[model samples]
Target: MTNPIPTEKTPPDEAPRFAELAGQVVVVTGGTRGIGLGIVRLLARSGARLMITGRKAHRLERVADELAKLGAEFETRVSDVADRDASRRLVDETLAAFGTIDALVANAQSYINVKPLLEITPEDFDLVLDTGPRGTLWLMQAVVPAMQARGRGRIVTFGSSMGQTGAPGYGPYSAAKEAVRSLTRTAAREWGRFGITVNCICPASASHRLPTNLDGDDPRARAFAAMYKDHPLGRDGDPLADIAPVVAFLLSDASQYLTGQTLMVDGGGILRA
Candidate 1:
């Protein structure tokens, strides 16, 4: 059996209209590969000066170099988002490199193997919580101060379908992402007075690593595939095509009136209720 490949059709214009992001400084965490990388690519193509952070120095540098060819002013930092000090350093470095941060995409996260709640050790729980929820909180704390000072900013936090529906064997991950959703709402409420917008996206696009995370033979995976088969769009969603534009909209002034909202990009997978 062959693995299903995800695909998307190009928009009619083959170009985005919200070019206001040009000259803006944006930071994206965990941007070395997968969905994060897709966001970085789209944002760069839209002419934002991008600063990306990840734990791997080589991969960060490689991605920075690739984006440079597309006329994006790029910078990279090797930092683990789970570390508060490192997260602060990432923001400081971005400000030092780009002068100001106009938008932030908190996309860094670690996935653990699906196991029974009792099977998960305290250490495993700590690792996921630290990387997903705690990291997001610290990063927001570090950046929002500056954004608030400026009286304008955009923040996009990542959530998951599992987080919304509480899938089995993914307790820790779901819990962490739920916390992210909560944080997003809270930030939007508190920061809106300062002209800052905070929102979360529950992205359901296919990725190379997600299949391995889900047990290949599990009934859950089969159910997911069948849902996609009968999706309203008749295909798996592409992160670049389906997810990136929404993110760009949230980041741009186009979505200035929107905040404290969770947008689902799941090809109607979670809407089968």
Candidate 2:
């Protein structure tokens, strides 16, 4: 009897985890860094045609180059999601580039500002809400019509555990994120009949760390660090391993029955009943 040859396995990093997503078109806001970047990387590798938006031209170019290396077809746009016109333009461009929008990841957000509830000014509230719920609302309006035309779409918006838990120091960000949840629920209800699904992910991912302020002495920074230490997994969520797959699932047909839910992806840091 002849001995059978052993098959070589593809390395985990090189394998496509969601090849079924091949040919799907997706738009990701804030796709240049952190969780957004992670989502883009995964989706690209899964063979999605992507239109990614970022506020920085240089960062968008950098991410574009990286996606090219993955052999992913992508278009880059420099736009702030908070601009309603820009949000509409982004959806139009994505539709123009890919012919249709199958999914959207509303991942762009304003910088987090830690402040006491009493100290959070109206301006602070605006800064968060304007970029979050307001931004997402307009973006949804832009894309939903196309989804309705097709009779199907997926939308995944970012929320936070802080919003659900009502964490004290994250007043403004939490309020903005909670508003997003309300919006997600309402949209899911309204859009369900049109075969569009809306959901939010409250992630405790490490990629939320900002590059500009790596302060060691700040109380807010300390609290941020303490979260990872206290998590059941003993670490923060990795955007690639912990979060992107959930976003991918929400985008895929596998989750067609799911909608209007906020999932906490926080290593058991915040569990909702």
Candidate 3:
């Protein structure tokens, strides 16, 4: 049989929207770039009121400019969610801006080091853990009360398939993501009674490295290109087209009954129930 060409669907600009997401207020961490930015674009088109945060003011401004071109108005703040105070402040600001937060997308993580286990340092673990699971928890804690008050909420946390597959040279990233998975399950169970749903998405996509950032000479360029070269769907996913829709579902009223589950949004590169 001949090989199939990789699919690149919708071009992100044509991302579909769920009707229930209209007018909902959502706080998104690391919304300045990559998959997070894709979520911002989709949710914006879906008419969700966006409260976006990131570490870089310049990139945040760029996001605002891009959204303006699409006629999507949004609020942005420079935030480091790894800091407890910062996480709380993001939620407070979201509430202040939009009155109430309907959903939260914890999509930020700092990958400080990608090296073999034997070469990883204590600092690697610290950086990844602080930004990954710890930051996720802080934001969840800060946002849950608002959801609880409303007796309804949706939380989407990020995880990685490498957390279980133990992909090479990703020691810190793997550990941090696994912790996030644990947090997702626990939060789902505890918050389910309050009409809140917590879910995790493990995505494998090319969104993090946009075409503008690609340099053919980079050592990992080929690796990134080849990630899903032989996949079941024949390609790595486009973050906005493949991943953001799932997130939108989890955020909308349609997914109210689903909780404590991990959805692999990776175009079938790795299958897991």
Per-residue accuracy of model 2 over 60-152 as CA lDDT, tens digit each: 999988888878899999988889999888898888888999999999998656778889788888889899999999999999999999999
**Rank by lDDT (best first):** 3, 2, 1
Best by lDDT: 3
> Which ranges in model 3 have alpha carbons more than 4 Å from their true place?
1-4, 210-229
Q: Which is the winner by lDDT between candidate 2 and candidate 3?
A: 3
Per-residue C-alpha lDDT of model 3 across residues 1-273, encoded as one tens digit per residue: 122355656777678987788889999999998899889989998888899999999999999998888787579999997899988988888888889989999999887644678888888889999999999999999999999999999999999877866666767898899999999999999999999999999986555552332234342443344454456776656778888999999998778889999998887766521
TM-score result, candidate 3: 0.91
lDDT value for model 2: 0.83
lDDT of 1 by residue, 192-232 (tens): 99999999998764454445323357745644554454455
- Among all windows of 10 consecutive residues in model 2, the one with the lowest summed lDDT is 1-10
Model 1: residue 66 alpha-carbon error in angstroms: 1.0
TM-score for predicted model 1 compared with the true structure: 0.90
- Total colliding residue pairs, candidate 3: 0
Model 3 RMSD in angstroms:
3.2
> Where in model 2 is the C-alpha error above 4 Å?
1-16, 207-217
